[model samples]
Target chain A: MNTILRYIFLNLFVRLIVNIILGVNVRNRDRLPEVGPAIIIANHNSHLDAMVLITILKQKAMKIVRPVAAMDYFLKNPLLSWFSQKIIRIIPLRRDVKFVKEDMFSDCYDSLKKNEILIFFPEGSRGEPEKISVFKSGISRISEKFPNVPIIPVFMHGLGKALPKGEAILVPFFCDVFVGNSFQWTGDRGSFMDMLGTRMAALEQEGSYL
Target chain B: MPFNIIVCLMGLFVMLSIASTVVFVLKKIKPQKDYKELSHRVKSWWIMIIIFSLAMILSKKVSILFFGFLSFLALKEYLSMIPTRRADHRVLFWAYLSILIQYYWVYSGWYGMFLIFIPLYVFLLLPLRMVLIGQTQGFLNAAGTLHWGLMTTVYSISHVSFFLVMPKIGGLVAGNGGWVLYLVFLTQFNDVAQYITGKTFGKHKIIPKVSPNKTYEGFFGGVIVTCVLAYLIAPILTPLSPIHSIIAGLIISTAGFIGDVVISALKRDLGLKDSGAMLPGHGGILDRIDSLTYTAPLFFHFVRYLYY
Candidate 1:
């Protein structure tokens, strides 16, 4: 009951704020998954991107979508820690791991086993708005672990202007999210990364203005 | 009844009637391309204005709360459009939280604390929040942006309410609520005057690259006309000398132009046509209030120095 109320409040809160202030223009919402466990891959540009994705996805899906964020970054303080874990329901992962231990892999595997959608940014960090960076192997690893689950690629544009790197002032701008058709993941390591990168790049190419 | 309050109420009614008539005529002649959308938007505006005008007349507390929420919405829109990295989320949270607290202080009538709330408390809190996140990448930029949004949208806007809460300027006056209304009226009038004059008589663009619609002729003409109106209206709403009323008009008109340009540049950089489509022909809440952002702070400081 509490979760339901929270979701309702969060949905209304985000919609009212975004529509009134941010002027967020959401498109291709039909592409989002109606039901099931899947991987949501998106471009990382602004902090608001996570909120935008969560807000839009919540409108369609029943089960809560969990965003995989860096523990070192989002979980560093009490307020943010609580907000991420409790409100946003983000799963925290250590970014600077020296080696991928069996324990770490199992934790991620366990999240997938729960039949929950997990959002991942293939680029470990935000990159230039004009270009997509070389993706890390996180998506491939998740794909290999959960071959049965669908991998959904999403592309977000205009958040870079909403809050760009090295600029503190937030200039008002419009942003759109495009969710692409999902595909089943194969355990093949090399092909998996290439396919993921290719799909993300295609989304970027289609969405890019310049 | 106090002479100024009675006169101001009469003037407000007359001006509102004129504005309504003009809007109604424009609706008939132009016949909005999207009539349904325009009607929806105008209905919302009527609701908002009715609520706002009632708050102003009925309860000081409600008026303060309404304006505070307006500033909060404006700031939220500004922040949502900017791109902050994951590292800056903590700072963003603090920045938004400060909006609530800043307005609360204004409502509570803590004059001294309200003065330092943003620069002292918020300035210190944002950086500390960033530091706690332990990532210095884009630290300076994120903190600075958060502060800028708060300063303009929250701190600046709260001053309008502050003017209302202030104790009588001298034993002769009870409160400067009239002055608050006067300032808003004059500033918005300057905006309308500039638009009408520029559209009618403007030929030479002031800054073609920045805002092509703005003209030197329109600017000077608008300022002169608004100043005259300010002079005529001041006695009805405020206890200002004619010279002071003229000064107030000049200040609001000139400062309001700067605010418009600043937000215009923001839109240009972002490659956007409108801030949002919340208002038809008016753009978003940010678009409508962009001029207020600058004028509010300046007018507040001016009233504070002279009266308080």
Candidate 2:
């Protein structure tokens, strides 16, 4: 009953506060995993992108999908910190460092291994909408670590317009979420990043108009 | 007390009877190809109406919060639909804060502060925010977009709450705040009546490019019917004379149509079908409240100027 209440409240709260205020639209969500351990790789444009993606995934998967957010930024403010951790269940990654400790990557690998979905922005950081930034090798590393896990590429267009990087007010606009087919990582580590980048680039091109 | 309870039960029965009859009639009509989708949409409406009724009856604060949350969603959707750059993020934060403050001002019944909350503070803060962010490129366009979101979402919808906060006019039926429910009921009724009338008698597309479903026949027919209904229901709902009620109905209905068209244009520009799929048939929070965005502000100002 508590779970039901939480779900209802979360739905109501998000509907009232986020979805209404931001006018986020989750499209082409049928391609998402209804239930399973998978990697949700989406284009990063704005802070709203993370919320929009996670909200839609929760709605689609009907389960909590932990988003891998940059710990430095999201955990800075107390209010945002609480919301990101409690409400969205964001898994914070220490990104400023040159090399992430082995323990952190192992924890992420464990989550994926345990059938939990992990959301990651392969670009490592947000960027301009006009171009998809060069993807960090972290995602490829994760994929290599868990070859059996499914990597779902999601392209989010217009999030930059919704709440751009430095801007606070959202311009009324429509955003699209295109969830592509899940694929496995079988290639060597050297070519894995190249292949992943190519796939992400393709999704970006396809969903650019959205 | 027994008599009052009996009368309330009788009224409940009558309302249910009327609703069922309408549903029966609608069911008898031939189902369109989109009937499944339409039925799903109607079911969602029933769920929402039930929720609204419960909230209104349960607590005033709950109802206000509910509506405030809705306005928040509508505003969010409006802003999301437009384009912005990285430089405009700070302004966006202020925009969200403005939504919260506007609603808070309304609930507090401080009409004086609510008046200039947006145009004064927000208008100034947005540019200053962008300047602080130090990105001058596309500054004007970004500020304008942020301002538009605040105007439509926060400033406009707060008018409804403002009505609730208005000093009650005398000479009306005692104990039920004057015309707060009246304007809200009539405006929403206008929306319902327009949709029904348009679907039934609509022909000769009106602004096919912007809103393909709207028609001139629907627009006029909805307004006339709503005005007549408003005239009849005024005595029960408000202190307005039949003539004034008729005028109010006409204003709300016509303005509501314009509201739909304006939001429709926004959606078209963004190449979107609905604002969001939060509501199954209703599209999104924005799609459902698009009409309210215009009607609430216009009706609030109209009532304030005329009555208050």
Candidate 3:
């Protein structure tokens, strides 16, 4: 019942915000995975990043798509925690090592085993708006475990300005979402991170006019 | 609601039906060619026409509100495309807010405030707001760009809605709806006419630096076509005589061409193609309404001077 309600609400809310309120230009959207057990890595700036990503996918495919968010932020209050977990369907990960006991990747791995598509923002937290920061190694560690799963790199522009960190009001702005080709696991951590970084940088350049 | 508007809309539907048939036939003839973009454009036109007709037929208030929404979209597109300083976000908020106030003047029929609110009041006040922000590095550029955007997108476009509140003059056959329809239809028609004629017979480039596809052949061809249509439709839709209608067409064509190339120059300066991807194959709200930006204000004042 919760899943059905969440899907229905998100379908309407996201479509209204994305299609009617904002002008979103998506390129190479076909690169998104059709089935599950895949990792979609994108640069994070605004909270709208995940919403925009969710809005762009096919409706059926969107049901299996789950965004990995930090527990400290999204699960702060009781109401927010319930809303984030039930409505947004985020896989909450502990950001603070002091509070975490078991392995953090356990829930992520379990979801992947269930054939769910996971969205990872490798930049541990939202950095300066519109600027890409160095990605943390959480994504590489997870990708190593699921070597066969494809990783799709996406770079989005203008969302940061639309509803950036610390800004609640969403200014209607034209946004661009560029989806790059999917790749599998590289040899080691450094090389895999380098490959992902290069792919994301190249995707960012694709949207740049100047 | 008026009989004249109903007749004009019927004519428009017939014209669109013919266009759809031609596009369908062309696609069947050239199976290998990519008509995806062209088809998308025609499909968008259908949607736009339906929305526009609904707004016009619903009520005067709805028509004004619809144009106000258009102004909002156009301003948002302009703000999104240009580079701005972070300190100017608050000023940008005010810029967006001005659209509501500008359109309110139209809704209330306050001609005095409608004419000078943006030019005299918002113009002076925006710089003051920027000064309060106190980030003086790119101050001049920021002020100039923001004000110019307001003038073009909000102030100029608001004149379109002002047509709704305009008092009907003597000898006018159709209602104010006809005036609005006439201006919008002619502006868009001129754009298509220039594009088609330019593609077919264009050889010498008119302005290679600004817009490469524009040519003298396209310019004169669009003018002649638009003028003839204006002469025919003016009697049915507007109060203009044949000679005045021809002059109105001349103004729209020339100003429409200028508006198109001017926007092209801005995009060239910004190193971008298309303002934004709001409409498939049509670019952005700004791109779709570029000619309207010039035609709306010019035609509004032109008609006001002659009739109202």
Candidate 4:
């Protein structure tokens, strides 16, 4: 039932609103594995990023993918928690550095074991929506734990300007999600995250959608 | 005042029948690569002609709204291909808003506001709104393209639909549908004539830098043929005399040719082969009506100045 609601809300309802508002486009979407336990790493630009991510996913990929959101942000209010639990189907991770480390490891590992495709903003949280911040160490930990899962680097453009940070109303803008090459972890956290960040940035530059 | 819609449709049906037969014989005779494309084009033409005639015959309001929606679609297709910075998005809404305003002028029969609103008034407004957005990067590029996009698609194309509201144009036909029919027929016929002649007899490139397909032989041939068609059909469809219709036909074909080439240039500059891929054989709404963008405003002004 939750999966059906998630599909309806994310795939159908949110996709509709996003298309009507942003006119989203996706390129090289077939690059992602059709049926696999994978981690989606995209540039975090707006509140619209996750929904836009869902909009860009081909139906099968959309069903398995769940955005890994901060527990503090999503699971705080009861209504938001219900929405996050039921419709968005978010894999909530604690953001607090001390308490989050152990809990984050287990929640993510369990989700990956269950074959849920997890979405991560390796930058950890939204920054100055236009700029790609240095990725945090969390993605490295997750990918290191699950060496088989492909870390798919996705780059989305124009959503920062469409919704951005702290903006309640969406301005109509053309947004595109460019799917890039995914690679497996080789135990180096620093260079891997750096390379992943470079790959995501390369996707943006390669798009030439300026 | 009432031109014969039934006769016009019958004429179109006869033309299609002849075209189908010729294509059938040609396909059987020589298995050329162009035959498949030619067959696809002819099939698309049949559908386009029927739907266009139906919309025009429906009602005046329906006809106006139909073209208005078309202009909106053309603009959407044009802008979708052109790259704009993030900051210019807010300004895009206002640019789209001009379509409604431009069409409302057609609806209300307000000529004065219709003439200058998009080109002059909205021209100033779009940039001002962009300036307020505070992004300096690509400011000029964004504003200029949006303004031109609206002007080319909405303001100019509105002239075709504007025929419905012209003071004395209703007296030229039962409804304004015939005037629209006449304009569209000549414009489209010019396109077909150019393509068919260009494919068959074209040797020298007219302006290869812009449009590789346009040939000098095709240009002169299409102009001469479209003019003859206009001269022959004008008395049956529009208010112009044979001599006047010949001149109008010459102007439309020439202007139509220029419009098609200019849009080709736009596509080339943007590194796009076609404006879009919406229509199967036709390309995009912009590709379909690039000539109408020039022909509509030019023909509207010519008729309005002398008659209305």
Candidate 5:
């Protein structure tokens, strides 16, 4: 009950303030899967990008959708750890896999088994804002195990300029988050990731996402 | 503050209420695309009017800030739509700074400084800023787009508030807000008149390449109706005599029409259907006030030349 209330408060109020300040323009919101599990992948730029993706989702979808963020960063402090665990519903992943825990992958699989959606920034970390780094293979590597978990590529623009990685103050500027169509994993990681990258970049050149 | 001008404003409110009711009824009856658009516009207008009137009623300072805030939004939309190269990032910062400086010039009523701030100083600073940045790629395009955005949004919009501070020109209420209301009412009413006339009697397209829906029929109908509306309202709302009111009406209608088309040209070049999605039916702040951009400067200087 508390989590539901917190989700509603964050989505309705907290996100509203951020979205307003950022002037977040989320297009193709209906492209989100209404029910069941899917991995939402986007080009990471600023910390705000993950929050933007979560804010853009429908309340119904947001309930089941979990953003896959870095454990070291989000769990660094007790407050962030508590908020990520309780309110925002973040799934932290261990980036340093020298001590790989099988439980991390299984936890994601278990979330999917519960028919919950997972949001992943395939770029792995926040790259230079406004520049889409070549996507890492974390998403594709995880997707191989669940072939049917569709991948939705979302392209975000103007976020780096709005609130860059190190900037403390947010300059209220236009930010467009364009949600592309879903693609089923074809078991070929390289080609699928290439196709995803192309589709995401194309939104910047055209007005179709708007 | 006068009884007659207050009545005139009340009449406008009544007319808007009637229009909103009609659109609401139409939506209930059939909910067609056109009616939906009209209803959305009506709803937005109510919000715009309420906020504008509140600011105006509060004081001249609030009204100036209100218009400044509007220009700020319009500038944001303009800057966002264009591709201001990263090299011009600092130059763009200077350009955005013009919003504050120019609006302050208007609010402070620094007539001499406001006249040359953007056109002269900002123009000089823009190229110099880019040169210092040392990035030569698309230099001309970047500078030109930023200059044009400032010229149209900030310089043109400041003229609206210049009406507020203009020295008394023997009229009903001087420049307290009479002329400001007159200019806005005419230009905006011209827009609605043209759209309605075009939809009803449009046959021959007027420069369909620039704006497809503008028609010869709409063009004439809007001018004639807006002229009459201006003639009736100008005396109560502005200092213009019967003859000058007629002239002001004609100037506003024709100029407003051109302004709307000019923005249409810009958007067409940008390959955008609308400037932005800020307003549901209206498109963007820039779209909403395109006519005002032309009418405000033209009327401000016209009034200033003769009176201020």
Candidate 6:
């Protein structure tokens, strides 16, 4: 029953916010895996990023998509926690440096073990609008354990201008989503991070051509 | 809403259906050459036609609101394409708000306010808002591009909706709907005519830098075809005489070509192809209606001077 309601809520949110208010143009949509144990990584800029990523997935696939979000931001209060975890199904990660490093990715690992798709923003948090910040090595550490899981790099433009961090009002803008080919972990953490950054940069360049 | 207007729209539907059928048969016959783009264009045409017809067929309020929404979309596209300073973000909001007021004037039949809202009022107000932000760097470019975008996308396109509130002139067969039908039909017809003629008999490049595909053969051929059709259909759809209709056709064709090239110039300047991917094969709303931006305002004033 909760699953059905989540689908309905998400579909409504996507239709009203993503599709109607801000038109989205997606390229190479077929590159995304149909079902997963996969990671969909994208640039962080707006709060709308996670919802926009969910909007592009198939209905059945949406059931298994879990976005990795900061626990402090999403699970701040009871109401927000319920809305985030129950409604949106986000996997809240503890961002505090004092937290135990070994157990940090337990939830992400469990979700992947269950054959779910997890979305990651290696930039850690939203930065300046339309700018890509240096990626954190947290994603590399997590992917090292699941070497076979395909990591898809998606570069989104214009959403930051639509609703950037610290802004409540949404200015409608035409957004472009460019999905790059999926790649497995390259075993080395440093090389894997570089590959992900280059892949996203390439997708961003591809969007500029048209 | 008029019976004759409905008949004319039905005729348009028939023509579109025939075109779709022809494309389908050609795709099957020549399976090697890519018909994917052409087929997508035809499919989008059907969707556009349905939406346009429904908006016109609905009451005046819906039609006005619909066109206002279109202006909003065009403005959004324009803003996304151009690079603007961070200082102009609030100014951009006001620019969008101006669309509401402009369309309200159309709904209320206040022609004077509608005429000056964007060109005179919003034109002055935007720079003031930007000035308040106190960022002089790239100020001129931001102000100029933002205002110009509002002019082309919002102010120019709003004239189409004004046709709804236009007083019904005597001897008008299809009322305001026919007036709109006449203007839109001729404008789009001119575009298609030019493309087809240019593809078939085009040899001389009219302007290679701005638009590579435009040719002298296409321009003359489109003008001839549109003028002839305008002469034939003017009396049935509008109150224009044979001579006046021919003149309208000439104005629309030339103006349409100018609009197309102007946008092409913009795309070249921005180092991009097509504006956005709003429409599948057509590129964007701006891409599909680029010609209408020129034709709508010109045709509106032309008819207003002669009739209203």
Index of the highest-DockQ prediction: 6
Report the C-alpha lDDT of model 5 over B1-308, residue by residue, as the tens digit. 55664666677789889998888787788755467677778888888887877776678889898888888788878877876675555566667778888888887889999899999999998899899989998988888988888889999988988777766656656346887788888999999999999999999999989999999999999999998998887767776778878888888999999999999999999888888887778988889999999999998877777665
Model 3, residue pairs in steric clash: none
Error (Å) of candidate 4 at residue B226 is 2.4
lDDT of 2 by residue, B1-308 (tens): 12332333344346555765565567678543335555566666666666655544555577677777767677666665566675565567667777778878888888778999898888887788789889988888888877887788778877876766667576455223335455655666677777888899998898999999998888888799878877876676566767787888888888888988898998898898877667886777777777778888887777667777
Q: Compose the digit string of candidate 3's lDDT tens values, residues B1-308.
A: 88888888778788888888888999999989998888878877887888888898899999998998998888888888999776776788888889889999999999999999999999999999999979999999999999988888888889888988998777668888888999989999999899899989998899999998899999988999999988999998898988999999999999999888888888888888888877788887888898888888999999999887
Model 3 TM: 0.95
DockQ of 3: 0.57
Question: Which runs in model 1 stand beyond 4 Å of their true positions?
Answer: A1-210, B1-48, B169-175
iRMSD value for model 3: 1.8
Q: How far off is residue B70 in model 2, in Å?
A: 2.4
- Badly placed stretches (over 4 Å) of model 6 are A1-5, A100-102
Q: Order the candidates by lDDT, highest first — what do you get?
A: 6, 3, 4, 5, 1, 2
TM-score, predicted candidate 5 vs. hidden true structure: 0.83
lDDT of 5 by residue, A175-206 (tens): 77777889887768887777777878776655
lDDT of residue B199 for candidate 6: 97
- Which 10 consecutive residues of model 3 chain A have the lowest summed lDDT? A97-106
Model 1 C-alpha lDDT per residue in residues A18-77, reported as the tens digit of each score: 554466655567777766577788888767777777777755463558888888988999
Q: Best to worst by TM-score, what's the order? A: 6, 3, 5, 4, 2, 1
Model 3 spans > 4 angstroms off: A97-102, B32-34
Q: Supply the global lDDT for candidate 4.
A: 0.81
Return whichever of 2 and 3 wins on TM-score: 3
Q: Compute the lDDT of residue B151 as modeled in candidate 2.
A: 85
Worst 10 residues of 1 chain B by lDDT: B168-177
- CA-based DockQ, model 5: 0.29
Q: lDDT of each model, Cα atoms only?
A: 0.74, 0.72, 0.88, 0.81, 0.80, 0.90
- TM-score of every model versus the real structure: 0.64, 0.75, 0.95, 0.78, 0.83, 0.97
Share of reference contacts found in each model: 0.00, 0.46, 0.54, 0.21, 0.17, 0.58
Docking class of 5: acceptable
